[model samples]
Target: MILDFGDGFFLRQATVADHAALAMICLKTGDAGKDATGREDDPDLLGLVYTIPYQVLEPDLAFIVDGPAGACGYLLGAADTNSFNARLVSQWYPDLEARVADPGPDSSRWRGSDWLRHKIHHPDFAVPQALAAYPSHGHIDLLPQARGKGIGRQAMAFLEQRLAASGSTGLCLEVMPQNVHALNFYRTAGFKVLQDVGLPNRCIYVAKQLGFAPGVAG
Candidate 1:
């Protein structure tokens, strides 16, 4: 299912068998140096981000970067607001009151999109409003080896096409303002920031409209 985006790279839906490669990709992307909690290590929070989506949903919302060796990147989407996993946040973060648990909250912290977005984006036992307009949205990541290969651009385009064919009106995602490089990348790809999420990392929600029916084949 590799999509030749030209320029020597392609995007494809990830499979269950890709767990190992995807795990490695997560390590590289989530790597945040070393730590005792064993969470704020490399490749950072990407592992937590990717794994939750993959474990909760499947084929409908996961894409990957394929090159000469294996998966170099991945994009994940979770459209269903009532998903069981969405309700399991408490289980993962039982110490919700421990916001100040870390001495350096400024660093080694992951942003949870503010409560409002969570309320709207992650409703209880009901689909989100955005799903009617956007349906599915998630993050994209590319390994260092696959950087500058146009895989990210091709991936966004491909997902937009696929989601549109599946009846999605648009796609949404967020990026840290501090990540100027990533902000520029999504901007270049036609995504615009919609609002500030006000998380620890200062994330901003961005979206791209697909003005057509979804799942249109390329």
Candidate 2:
């Protein structure tokens, strides 16, 4: 199913060729659901950590929303969280560890590239309960220009179908408590709060089963 935007948008499987453009979109919408063109100097921080690796490891699982201008949004992640996280730290993190610059002493209040760099060294996960119950996860980012186009919902539904087909029983994701819009979207998408988390970061862990109620849509 092609989830198009306006009259000219369409969806396609993300390829290596789209890496740079996808990373740019990740940066453009990195600031808590807003445009952050000047928010950080490094455009690869978020994508390198959260996005690029997923595409690199599981190319077919990644998809992009394309428009006349360029890539406007994308859904990138793995089907199995436990395995994906293990591979990420053991295999993927090592590659990024050498390149990601260290965060300063006051990195606690940092955002954008600085905070992203910090996270590279200190990987975070959802709460234990959530992790045990929902073993698949990923993230989605849509540029401001892509919002209100129903692309988010379409992208999510497509992702759910893909995940369910992959044999994932459930999916999970970590969201910052402050992103109210995201929280609402997840709720509408059939995700429920699994629990509150405060380990590596203060956030709420949300989840959805794959084949039933409180589940990802068809």
Give each prediction's root-mean-square deviation over alpha carbons.
7.6, 3.6
Give TM-scores for every candidate, taking all chains together and pairing residue i with residue i: 0.64, 0.85
Off by over 4 Å in 2: 1-6, 104-112, 125-127, 196-201, 212-218
Error of 2 at 200 (Å): 6.1
Query: Which runs in model 1 stand beyond 4 Å of their true positions?
Result: 6-8, 31-49, 80-133, 196-201, 212-218
Best by lDDT: 2
**Candidate 1 structure quality by residue, lDDT tens digits, 94-163:** 3332332332324333443233223323323343343345556666777777888777787778777777
Candidate 1 accuracy as TM-score: 0.64
